[model samples]
Target chain A: MAEVRLTTPISEEEIRKLKAGDTLYLSGKMFLARDEAHLRAIEMFDEGKELPFDFKGLAVFHCGPIVKQDDTGQWHVVAAGPTTSSRMEIFQDEFIERFRVSVVIGKGGMFERTTAAMKKYGCVYAAFTGGAAVLAADGIKKVEGVEWLDLGTPEALWIFEADNFGPLTIAIDSHGNNLFKDIADIAEKNRPKAYEIIGASKE
Target chain B: MEFAPIIEKVAFNLMKYSATVLPDNAIKAIKTAYEKEKSTTGKAQLGAIIKNFESGAEKSTPMCQDTGIHIYYVEIGADCPIDDLGKFREALTNASRKTTTEVPMRPNAVDPFGSNSGDNTGRYIPWINWEIVSGDKIKITAFPKGGGSENMSTVKMLKPGVGLTGVMKEVVDWMISAGGQPCPPTVVGVAIGGGADIAIKIAKKQLMRPIGEPHPQKEVAEMEQKLLKAINTTGIGPMGLGGNITSLAVHMDYAMRHPASLPMAIAVQCWAARQSAAEISADGKVKYLHHDIKD
Candidate 1:
C-alpha cells in the first residue's frame, strides 16, 4: 500500500500491483455518472442503443456536478466532487465489467460485490473526499462535453478531460483489498466501548 | 411594505455564500482535526477537504456537487406587516430559482412521481422557517445541506423515561453503523424534546451551529461534549478511513415536549455543511454577517 502515480489506459499489470490504502493520482480523461445515469447506461446497453461515450479503460466518477455554460455554449465545471459510492453498488459490478473502466472514483467505499468485481475485472475503487468538490475540480483541465442532460445536473453525464485528477485513495484495490471494511472492523470493536461511555453518562 | 425585492436578493446572496464559503468554524474544526489526525488516509482526507474549502471560496464555486437542499431560517420583526409573509414566501421561491442558475447549482429537486424542476424550485423547496423577533430587522441564515449527509439522519422515539443515556447510546450506535457514509469528521446534530418529526427537523437545523459552540443548557452542553468524545473514540475518523477525530463536533438543541414520549433525532453534516447568514434592515439595505463564523 504505497502512493502511486498512474496514468490511464492503465494496463492490467499496473493495476494488479496496487492495494487498498494506496494514494493514486489518475492523469487522463474521465466522465461523471450517478445512480440514475448508471441505470440508464445499463438499460441502454441491454437494448443495444448507442451509448454517449465509450467507457473502455477510462475512469467513471460518481458525481453530478455543478456546471455552468457561457454564452458560446461552452461548459465550465464549477465544482466536481465524488458522491457516496455505496449508492451505486447495485450497478457497479456490472458497470466495471460492461464498461471495462480501469478506475472508479467515489467515496464512502463499496462492498464485497464491488471488491470482487475489482479483483475479477482489473478495476480499482478510488475514494475521493466526499465534499471536496472544488478541490476535485482543480484537477480537471476541461469539460469535453456532457450527455444525458435529460437526467438533470445532479445526475447528468459530464465527460471531462482531466489530468492528475485526484487526491484519490485506493480504498478498494485490484487485488480485492477493501479499506472501508478494515476500518469498519476496528470501529466495530470500539463500538461496545463507546456504548460504555454512554452508559457512564447515566451516572 | 414592499420587502419582496430585498428578500429575493438576500436569499440569493445567502445561497451563493452557503455554497461557496465554508462557515469559518467548520474550516477551523477541520484544520484542528487535520493536525491531530493519526491515520495517513484520514489526514489526507482532511487536508483535501481544507483545500476544497479554499478553492471553492477563491473560485466562488459550489463546494460540493450535491449543493444539497437549501434550508433557510428567517427571523422577522414584530412590526413587519402580517400581509408581507406571503410576499416573503414568493421572494424565497424566486430567489431559489435565481440561485440555482447563478450559483450554477445542480438541479436537486425531483418530485415524488419522478419529475425534476430543471431549476431547484418546488413548492416547499429552499424551505424556510420563521421566527418573530422584537426588533425591526430581518435576519436570514441559509444552510445548503447536501444529500450524502442528510441520508444518514436518524430518529428514535423512546418511552419518556428511557432518559439521556438512551439518547446518547442511540447516537453513538448510529454513528458507528454509519461508519463514514455521511462523511466524517462530520458535525453531529442532536435534537430532543419535540415529537418525532419536529425533533428530526430541529436536529437537522442545529447542524447549522458552528463547531465548539456549546449547547446553552448546562446539562445538554455536557452531553454534547461527551457524545463528541465517544463518537470520535469509535475511530470512524475522516471519511471513515480511521483516525482520532471521527466527529468534529456534536451539537444539540431541544424543544418542549409531552411527558409520555421522548423523541431524539440526530442529523449528520459533512465537513462542508455550508452555511452563511445576513440581515436586511427595514429600509431594505442588506448586510452579510460573519460574527457567527466562530473559532
Candidate 2:
C-alpha cells in the first residue's frame, strides 16, 4: 500500500524488501526490450557475444515504443508503455538469471517459472498500467541509446534515462508472492459462481 | 467528383485521432472504474490509465506504444460519385502510410516470417471491410487492434444444445483463463450464431460500439448486462491485479445459424479502446462523427 521510490542501479536488497502490492516510482536507468530483443540478448549471451549494454541492477521494460527523431536526429520517445510480459515468460527466468536484472517492468505480469526465478534471484515484477504509453514516455527524460534497429523500430532495444517513471504496482515480489496468480486463483473459485449466475455449466 | 483524395484525408485523420485520443466514452468508463475500484493496485492502475490518455491528448502522442494494426470498416454509398472502387482501396492504403509518419504511429505490420513493413502496410494489411449502403456519403470507422488483445481473441464452435448458457459459461471461463494477458478492464465483444469466421468478424465489429452501450433488442441487452455483471464478479480488475471490474462492458451480437452449427467468438479491446469515425460526403466535406476534431 506504500508508494516506494526506486532508482537504478537497484540493489538485490532493495528489491527483496518490496512486497507484491506496493506502488513504485522508478528513476535512473531502464532498458526497453520486448520479444525480439529478449531472444537476441539471450542468444548473444549464450554465443559469448557481448551485448552493447550491461543490464545489471537495471529495470528491463517489456515495451516496443513509438520513437521519433527530430530534425537533429536525436530520437524522442513518442509512446513507451509496457508490452504484455507473459510473452517473455519463456526467456524471462533465464534473462533474470543471466542478466542480474533487479526489476522487470511490464504489463499483465509473468507466470510461474518467472515468478520462481524472481524469488530465487531477488527480482521483482512491477506492472505499469497497460496502455499508459504517454505517461510512460513522459517519465523517460532522455533516450540514452538504442540497439538492433534492424529488428525494426518497435523491436529495437532502447536505453532510456527515466525520472519518476511509474506508479508501477508490484505484481510479483521476490518472496514468491504473485498478485496475478492470486487473482487467477480467485477467478477460478468464482468461475462456478459465474456459471451459476448464468444458469450454465462449463461442461 | 474525386473521392480518393477526400477518403485518404479522412482515413488519415481518423487513424491519427484514434491513436492520440481515447474516445470520450472510454475515458468515462475508466474514470468510473477508477472511482469504483476498491483495491489499491486496481485503483492505481486505473488512475495511471486515465493520466496516460489525458497526456496523450495534450501532447498529441499515442496512448499506447502498440499503435496497432490498421483495420477499417467502410460503409459506402451505392450512388456515390466515386466510380472506381480500386481507387478507394488505394486511397485508404495511402492514408495508412501517411498516418504512419504524420501521427508517427508505430509501424505494427510485420510479416510472420520475415520482418516489419515499417509503413503499417503490407499484403492484406490495413484490412478493410466494405458494406454497400444507401447514401451518397461514405462512413469510415478506424478500429486499430493491438497485438495483446488481438492475440487473446478466440473462436469456438459449441454444440447447439449448449445454447446461451454455453456461450455465457464459455466466456466467463475464458476470461478467467486469460487473466492479465489481454489487458484487463477490456471491452469484450461476444458474437454468436454465425459461421466460425463470420462469428469472429462480427465479434470484432461489435467492439466499435461505445463502451456500455446496450444492444437495441431487449433480450440481447439483458444478455449483455448479465455477462457484464458475471465478468466483473471474477475480480480480475484493472490489469488483472485484482478488484471489482474485470471488464468495462460485454457487447454481444448474433446472427441466424445453420441448425447444426453454433459458433462463438470473443474479441477484446484493451482499456485504451481507441476508435474514431468520419463521414465523407460526395462533395468532399469531412464530418467527424465520433470525436470533436479541432482544426
Candidate 3:
C-alpha cells in the first residue's frame, strides 16, 4: 500500500520495513543474472575464487537482456526483462546468505526456500512486471560492466546502473508474507467451482 | 527458386515485426482487459504491460527480452514456381539470421553441444511447419514463442470415455499449475483427438488465429467459450496474482481420435501473443498481411 524509493546498497532495516503489496522504485547499482550466470557464480563461490563483482547490499535481477555495443565498446540495454525467479530457487538461499543481497527482483515469484531465506536474511523479493522489457530498460541508466560473456549474452552477468528503475511490487516481503502464494491459494480454492461448471472432477 | 529473395525478405520482416509490434487482436484484448480488471495487482501488471508495449513501439525494440525461438507456419501453393522445398527452407533460415542482428533479436537458438550459434538460425531452427494448397502464392506466419510460456505448454493422453469433461478438467489443472509462470493473462490453445505430436502442433497452430474469434463450428465454438469462462473463474488473473481475467481467450481445435486414444495438447501463448504474416505471389511481389513494414 505504500510507495518506497530505495537506492543501491540498501540495508536490512530498509528491506525489513517493506511489506508484501508495497511498490518500490529502485535506484543505484543492480546486477543481472539468470540460469547460467547463477550456476557459474555458485561454482566460483564454492571454489574459493575471487568473484568478479560484489553483490552485497545491491539487487540481483533474474534477467537475460538484449544488449548492443557501440563503437566506443559500451554496452546498452535494449530490452531487459525478468526471467522466472522460481528457476533460481535452488541457488537463491545460498546466494542470499553468501552475497548479503538485500533485494531480489524478478517475475513469477520465488518459492518457500527462497522466501524463508529472505525472511531469515532480512531481504525482500520484488517483481518487475513480467515481459515489460522496454519499460524495464527505460529505467536502466547505463550498463556499468558485464562478465561471463562466455556464457552467452542473455546468461552473462550484467552490471547496470539503474535510475528509478522500478515500479516493482513486493511479492515476497522479509517478514514471510508472499503475494504469489496467496494468489495460488485462492486459485486452488476456486478450482472446484470451475470443475462443477465444466462437469469434471479431479481424477 | 525465382521467388526465394521475396520469401527471404518477407520472412525477415515477419520476424522483426512480430518482435516489436503485437498483432491488432492482441492489442485490443489487452486494452479491454485493462479497463475491466478489478484486482489492484492485476491492474498494475496490465498497466505496466500496456506501457511496455508503447515503449517497445516507440523505441523499435523487442517487446520482451526472450525474443523467443522463431517458428513459422508456411503454406505454399502447388503451382508456385519455387518447387524445391529446400530453397524455401533456406530462404527462411537466412531470414532468421538477418533479423537476429538487424532487429537485434536475442540469439535464442542454442546448440545441443552447449554453444550458441550467436544467430537465431541453427539445425531445424526457424522451424517451419509446411502445408500446400491450390494458389500460386506462399503465405507465412511467424510465431515468436517465449520460453516461459512454452515451458507451461503440455500434452496428455486421456481415456476415450473421459470425453469433453476430461479435457476441461485437465485445462483447469494446467492453468492452476502454470500460475503466473506463463505470464498470464495468457491465451490458451487446446487441441483434442489427435496423436500426441499432431495434437501439440495443432494446439500451437490454433494460437495463430486472431484472438476472440470463435471457431466456425457451433459445437467447437461453444467449447471454446466454456473453457474461457472456466479459466477466468480460476482467479489466476493477470500474472496469476489473482483477478477476474486470468486468460484473454481459449481457442480449441480437434481431430478424429484413434479407437483407443484421446491425445490432447495445450499451448499457452503469453498475453504479448506476438505474431505476424506475409504473402508472396508467384510474380515475386510480397504483401505483409498483419503488419506494415516501413521502407
Candidate 4:
C-alpha cells in the first residue's frame, strides 16, 4: 500500500490512482460535518440556496469535534476523531454527486450503495482511526471557521486547515474494492471454525 | 456527613481525566495489540491509536471528540449519614456543568425531536445508577459512552433452548458485522439472564470492570477467554483494518432469570475505554483509582 500525502481539492486523477489498503496523510483544506450538517446541506439544496463553500474536489470528514475558545476568542480543536460513516449512508451518494467530493473520510464502513457511488462518481471513502480524537486534532493546523451554529456545536460545519491530517486507511477505493465488505466475508467464513473451537453449536 | 462538595469535585475531575486519558489497561492493551498485530495496516492503525492516547494526555484534551454522554455507577453506604439525599444527584449535575468549561466538553445532550441544550445537561444528564453498600464509604465510577460504540450495543431475548451455543453465535456475529464501526479492538460486555432492560443495563455496568480481569466463576472466565480468541481470529484486527485481534477483552456477567428466557445484552466500548473510579470516605477523605493523576 503506497502512502501518499495530498492536499484538499484533490484531483480526480489522484483519487483514481489510489487503491483500497493504501495509507494516506492528507493536508491542507478539509471540511467536517455529521448528521445535522448534512441535513442542513441538503436542505439548502432543496431551498435552492448555495452551499456555504465550494464543494468540488474537496474532502468532507464525518465528525463532531470538541472545540474550546481562548480568552482572545480564538477556537482550538481539542478532539476531532472521525464518526462512523454508516449512519450517513442514505445521504452519501447524493452528497458525493452534489458536492463532487473526491474523498470522504470516516470510520465504520458504509453499504453497497456507497460502494456504487464511489465507483460511479470517482470518490473514495477512507477510514480514519476511530476514537483517535486528540490525535486527529493535533494534525489540524487551524480552525478556519464553522457554519450552522444553531444546529449546536456537535452538528455544526467545521472547516479546518490541516497538515498531515491523517494516517487514514482507504477502506473503499474508487476501483470498487471494499475492505469493510471483504473483511465481513472473511469473518463469516471463519465463524463456523471459531464456533467449533469453542464447542458451541446447535445440539 | 457533609458529602456534597467532595462528590462534586470528584465527579468533575473524573469526567475531565477520563475524557482526556485512556485508562491504563486500555493503553496496555493497545500497546500489546500493536506488537501482536502482524499486518502493516493493522499495526499502523494500532500504533496511531496508541500515540493518540499519549497525545491526549500530553495536551490534556479528550482522547475522542465525542467524549460521549456520561454514565456513573455509584455505590452509597447504607450506614453513612448524609444530610441531603438530593445533594449527591445535584453534585453530579453541577460537576457535569463545571467540567463542560474545564474539560470544555461538547454539549451532546439533545431533546431527540428538538434541540441541544449546549451545556451537556438536561433531563437526566450524567445519568446515575445507585446501589447501597455495607461500608460507610461511597464509591463512584464514571464511564463515558461514545455514540459510535453505544449505537452498536444490542439486547436480545433468546428461547433458552438455543442454549449457550446460540448465545455465543449471536455474540460473535455482531462483532463481525460491527467491524470497525464501534472501533475494533473493542472491549465487549455481555449481560446474561435478565429482563430485557435489566439485561442491557447490567451489560453496560459489566464494562466498568478493568480490562483483562477474569470473572470469578470458572465457567464464565473460560467462556470469556474462548470468545476473546474467537473474535480476534475473525481478522477484524485493530480499527478493523485486518490484523489478528478484533477485541482486547470480552466480559460477560450473569444473573438469574425466568427458566424459559435468555435475555442477553452486548455493551460495546471503543478502544479509548475511558473510565475513572474514586472513593469518598464517611469522614470525606477522597481517593482516586484506576489511573494516576500525576503532573
Top model number, DockQ: 2
Q: What tens digits encode model 1's per-residue C-alpha lDDT throughout A1-203?
A: 58788776787788888888778888877889899889998999989998977888888999888888899999988888888899999989998888889999998989999999999989999999988888888888999988888777778888888888886888888887898999899988888778777675423
Sorted by DockQ (best first), the order is 2, 3, 4, 1
State which docking tier applies to candidate 1. Answer: medium
Where does model 3 sit among the CAPRI classes?
Answer: high
Candidate 2 wrongly placed segments (more than 4 Å): none
lDDT tens readout by residue for model 2, B223-265:
9998988888888888888889789999999999999999999
lDDT over C-alpha atoms for residue B215 of model 1: 88
Model 1, residue pairs in steric clash: none
Q: Write the per-residue lDDT of candidate 4 for residues B163-241, one digit (tens) a residue.
A: 8778888898888889888988899999889799999988887778878899899999998998898898888887777
Which portions of model 3 miss their true places by more than 4 Å?
B83-85
State which candidate has the highest TM-score.
3
Per-prediction share of native contacts kept: 0.82, 0.89, 0.76, 0.82
Task: Pull out the clashing pairs in model 4.
Answer: B1-B81
User: Tens digit of lDDT per residue, candidate 3, span A1-203?
Assistant: 99999999999988889999999999999999888888888889889998997889999999999999999999998999999888899899999988889999998878899999999999999998899999999899999999989888988899999999889999999999999999889888988878877878644
Tell how far residue B50 is off in model 4, in angstroms. 0.8
Question: How would you encode candidate 1's per-residue C-alpha lDDT over B162-256 as one tens digit per residue?
Answer: 68888888888889888879988899999998799999999987787768799888999999998988998898789988898898889998899
Query: What is the C-alpha DockQ of each candidate?
Result: 0.75, 0.85, 0.82, 0.80
Error of 4 at B179 (Å): 1.0
Q: Write candidate 2's Cα lDDT for A1-203 as tens digits.
A: 77899899999999999999888999998998898999999999999999997899999999999988999989998899889999999999999999999999998878999999999999999998888888888789999989999999989999999999987889899999998899989988888778777887544
